[model samples]
Target: MFISETQIEVRYAETDAMQVVYHGQYVVWFEIGRTRLIKDLGFHYADMEKAGFVSPVTDIQLSYKRPFRYGEMATIRTWIQSHSGIRTTYAYEIVNETGDVCVIGSSVHTVVNKETFRPVKFKKEFPEWHAVYEKEKQGQ
Candidate 1:
């Protein structure tokens, strides 16, 4: 699969009063990872938005395995787990410098017309992008 890795330094502002990363920050990191993954695969989310489509996460599942402190660097590995005519699911892993997984999660999203909010079949709207995704998902 087309996996992309992104590194982020834990900023002080992203931490809680306890100095550990705030739980909500992980979701932001998830977005960073997903964006990077798509870009690395030669597609831009902005381009899709410009074409009158918006992809919104319909579901998310996160599992926290360890804590991350401010000033540390975390690596987020992301990949497209699955893709269909309407929805795409992405998998993610946030790992510490030592390569230990600190968080594991996945997000499911569906493309919709920006104005109408009706679901869009990606394959019909962007056949080339869809073909790339299908090839990537097969690890070709």
Candidate 2:
């Protein structure tokens, strides 16, 4: 599988009263990782939207392993877990500078038509993008 890694520095404002990263901040980190992954694969989420398709998360689950303090560096590892005709699942792992996993999670999203709200099959609309995903997964 092709995994994309993105690094982020924990900001003080993102922390809780205890000085640890707030739980909700991880969800935003997941998006950063996912967006970077898509862009690294030569596809832009904005382009997809411009094509009249919008991908919205249908489900999300996150597990917090350790607390991250402000000013610490964290890395998000993201990969395509699976992709079907209408939905795609991305898995993620957030690790500290020492490579300790701080969080593990996933998000399930479906592509829908912007106007009609109907599901879209990526293969039909973006064949090359789908093919790249398939090839990378098979190579793994």
Best by lDDT: 1
Q: What lDDT score belongs to each candidate, Candidate 1 first?
A: 0.93, 0.91
- Against the true structure, candidate 2 reaches a TM-score of 0.95
Candidate 2 residues 28-130, lDDT tens each? 9999999999999999999998999888999999999999999999999999888875778899999999999999999999888999988888889889988
Q: Over the stretch 34-127, how does candidate 1's per-residue lDDT look in tens digits?
A: 9999889888999999999999999999999999998999999999888886888899999999999999999999999999999989999989
Root-mean-square deviation per candidate? 0.7, 1.0
Q: Provide the lowest-lDDT 10-residue window in model 2.
A: 131-140
TM of each candidate vs. truth: 0.97, 0.95
TM-score for predicted model 1 compared with the true structure: 0.97
What's the lDDT for candidate 1? 0.93
